[model samples]
Target: MSMQLNYNWLLVLLSYAVSVLGSFTALQLAVAIPLAATQRQKTAAVVMAGGAMGLGAIWAMHFIAMLACDNGMDVSYDASLTALSALVAFAACVAGLMLVGSGRFDWLRLLAAGICMGLGVAAMHYIGMAAMMMPAKISYASGLVALSVVIAMVASTVALWLAFNLRGPLQMIGSALVMGVAVCGMHYTGMAAASFEDNGGQLPDGYAEGLRGGNLGLTIFVVVTILLVLMLVLHYWRQRYRSSISI
Candidate 1:
């Protein structure tokens, strides 16, 4: 039997909102990379930006979207795989940000960075998907899977371009919006790629010990709260710095 999958629309919206907030925060940090006079400052900015994008925008949003999914089964996540997915997301974002943030921005760098970030997002999504533990076996359609990856790469490229190459408020706002598209589009598309089949009600090993929806919900709440506070801090810091510079 094939499991009928559905989603909570509100949680889906919340996932997108989290993605935008994370993107805005990351891009705000990213715009300062070129202005960093020291290698340490540049490295710090890159790492921070990477964390925001990877952990906050990509990983957190992925899980929230997962929570929004109701696959008509009792599902839990493998803690180890879940953690690995997050690390992958963080590492990929860091590499992409570092590549584009260093030296002069060029087309080649942007292309490479986009590929890195896009593939990272895709990989994180699938890996996170793999973390699901239920009485069903999952599979993907090759066509939609490929489409999801392409959507990620193309939109991620566009988002990075908007993030680093834009001016004033548009710099943060535009990239964040497009990046939300990159994150959410790839996600739902990937979800569309998946088909779940029943396995005679046989649950995977350790399903009893896996992280449940309640656990994930609490984690996501904390993450969103942190992201909101970070955005506010960034806003305040930017305002004060601008005022001081103009004085």
Candidate 2:
């Protein structure tokens, strides 16, 4: 028998929304990274902001997308692995931000930063997949995985370039939209790369057995919404303070 993957379209749409919101916030933070008054402040801001972006954009988006997936089997996740995957995502985002925001705008640096960011995003995806504790063994197509990584790298490079080069609200909005599409594209492509084999194994204890797709989606939605609001408030406050100081 052939295995089929089913997805809840509603949840998939919600995942995309989460991605967009995360990308927008990340872009805003990226733009602000270079504007810090001091080197220490810039580094700290980049790490914190990058972690927040990774949490919402990469980690949360991946989780929500997984929630949308159904392989006609009972699926749960290893709590520790899941949490660790988020940390990995945050670290990757921080590395990417640091590389791009390092006060140097060169092709080599951009390429290096893009590759690092791409690999980080891809690593987060695969790691999160590993966290799934289902009664099956998971595998991947090598080609699709490579393609997804390429998409992530290219998109990440573009996003970083836009973050560094673009000015004003309209440009930022456009960059966010494009970056969101890139993030979603990489995710779905990675999903396409995955296949499961029934191993007749049992799910382990202490996994995320109680969480369902809808419930997880609702939780992510609420969390991301709150984060977005907080980010906006911080951005505006920072802007106002900077304006006052410049006078």
Candidate 3:
């Protein structure tokens, strides 16, 4: 039997919102990574920026997307696994930045960084999927799964390139849009790969009821909003300091 899937349009829209926000934040961090590498004192800042991108963009986007999915079965999540998935996403972002932003730009480095970042994203997705404590057996279509990985790797590579090369506000905005699409594409495609089977069983102990889609969406909105504000403040402060030093 064909697997049935239902999506809440509102949640789906929210997922897109998170994607865009995350993409912009990531691009900002990508631009900062190389600059930070030039100054050892900024190393900690780079990591913080990377963590923000990973947590806000990659991990949050995935979580919101997952909440958008409905399979007509009782579903919840394991709290610990859910939290761990965020850490995985953060680590992936930091690794990607460190690899590509080491002040040694090269094709090989780009490729390796892209692969690592892509795989990191895929790992976070699957890990988050595993966090779902539903009474259904989940399976994936091998072909779609492979396609999703390819998309993630290629998109990540291109995004990193743009971050390193692009300049000006318009270029940044354009890059962010492209990256947002790529991130969302990888996510929904991965979602397409998933197929669920109801096993007629109950969730195991320690499984907390999942947040309602609406609730999750609202929470993500608040979190992303706060992060964006912080990013803007940091950006402004950095620019101001640079201006002062130039004088």
Candidate 4:
């Protein structure tokens, strides 16, 4: 029989909040890339934006959502895979942001970047799911899996376009809202694609040693706190930049 899966609604809301905040910070960081006067400045912007999107928005939100899941079974995650998944997400966001942030914007670059990010996000989610060490086997519905990927690509492209093309308050809030949709949509859809079947208590090796929910909770808290700081810093920096140019 499949486990009776449920969720902590508060955590689900928090997951979305984290996604939005990460998206907001990343989108704001990316908007400044075009105005960067040198290669070094552009590179710095890309890295910061990528980190905000990948680590804060995608990776951290994923773990929070995972922790929110109440599967009625004790679960742990493989340390290496968990780390690898974050790396993949970070690298992908960096590459994608770099591609679109540099040079003149075009459909081709947008498409390519979207595909890269979309695949990366999907890959991270699946890889994270694989990190689970529990007494159950998980399978996915092929169609829903594919649908989730499509949503990731489309939403990412739209968000990036909004960030690059728009100005004023709309740019930051709009792009971030869409990006939040991209992250949250892909996550929950991928989760919906999953079906967990009960196993004969054949837990994975080292399950006892794997990272547990309590560990992840603390990590998520730290990530959220850092994200908040980044947002404040970004806002302060933007204000300074605007004042300098206005004078």
Candidate 5:
């Protein structure tokens, strides 16, 4: 009995690990490639396409895990749901672009890159988490192992992308910051999406809550003000310096 129990536990651990890792890898593909796209748009597009396909791959892997563990995973919906989710995710990406563009940050270019990456991560997490359901009949623990793997893979990919693509100290720092935001966004979104639907979780609801919180709007206004002031000061200073050199 003892030996049998240990063998069963081992299978559980291994299966959990594999599924989580695959999911995390899916997240990485979503986040890193979008940020990298700013530098290599064509290459980035290819990466994005790969990421879309990866969704299916990860889902298949998760299904396999469920089968192995007798957890009973099924997708009762059609591919249209997947496509709809992808469209929603892309809309989030466009919103990120608009937000970054509206604010005049000291590092606007870098900020845009980071925001896009972060949004991608967030979209991937929530979308992936919302993709399936656990049968009320099967008493299996949530695949947190799979979720962790997805996050770690994403972080590592972002780090690698930054190391290879970003140049200059400031740019590197900006890229890192962006990737960090992406990771955080991804985690929260994934958690939210994975939560029980009846447990009061909706993406639009979260967005509205953030906006009504006032903090976000104030923070954006303050940053924009600071950036404007800095730009004015820099312009005058540059002119003075040039005038002196000419004289």
Candidate 6:
């Protein structure tokens, strides 16, 4: 039973690691360059734009990642369902945008963003699951799994955002990486929580084993090392090639 629980934990961590590494890296690539391009005078605009770009990129990455994984399979799931979900999310976002722009205390904006994220992540996973579903009948277990994923993602976002804000901007960049991992971790944890049977089949296990066997630890080490080296080399190259912008 303990072993089963451990395995379930492992599954969550593994899934989170995938999101952090894949989606986060994509986020950096998507947002960082644009931020660098903007001058200090336009800092606020750049910052906001960078954020919008980051979230947009994350969504794009999630969709494409699932679609890529779905390759050649019969994704006979209803296109309208996915479309409607996206439309609702868009409308919600628009409303949030208006609320924020209207200059009220904007409590609603935050709530809306949270709801948008939860639904967006949930819809993506459900649609992906639908695409991946075998002809076997759907069950309540599936709905629970979906709920778990959504809750985990929303929790992760809150956690990561808190962690990021606690740190300053320089640290915020690193926090974003942490946030990425948290997002992915939460997502997969949710996936793992899904009970396949009414009685709840043996709880999952394997945090350590999954870390090693799943190759997540190795992948993180390799990727982070490479990215660090790349960053160092780029830092030096930039110093040699371009004058630093004076604040």
lDDT of 2 by residue, 2-65 (tens): 3589998887887877777787777777777878878998897787668656888778888888
Q: Least lDDT summed over 10 consecutive residues: which range in candidate 1?
A: 213-222
Minimal lDDT window, size 10, model 2: 205-214
lDDT of each: 0.85, 0.81, 0.77, 0.84, 0.37, 0.39
Better of 2 and 4 by TM-score: 2
Q: lDDT of candidate 5?
A: 0.37
Give stretches of model 1 more than 4 Å off. Answer: 231-235, 238-247
Model 3 ranges with Cα > 4 A deviation: 1-3, 37-39, 209-214
lDDT score of residue 69 within candidate 4: 88
TM-score of candidate 2 to 2 decimals: 0.93
If scored against the real structure, what TM-score would every candidate get? 0.92, 0.93, 0.92, 0.92, 0.31, 0.43
Is 1 or 3 the stronger prediction by TM-score? 1
As for candidate 1, its clashing pairs are none
- Candidate maximizing lDDT: 1
Taking the tens digit of each residue's C-alpha lDDT, what string does model 1 give over 5-58?
Answer: 898887888889888988888777777678777999889878877888888888
Pick by lDDT: 1 or 5, better one: 1
Query: Where in model 6 is the C-alpha error above 4 Å?
Result: 1-18, 22-107, 133-135, 146-153, 156-170, 177-181, 193-247
All candidates: CA RMSD in angstroms?
Answer: 2.0, 1.8, 2.0, 2.0, 17.8, 10.3
lDDT of 6: 0.39
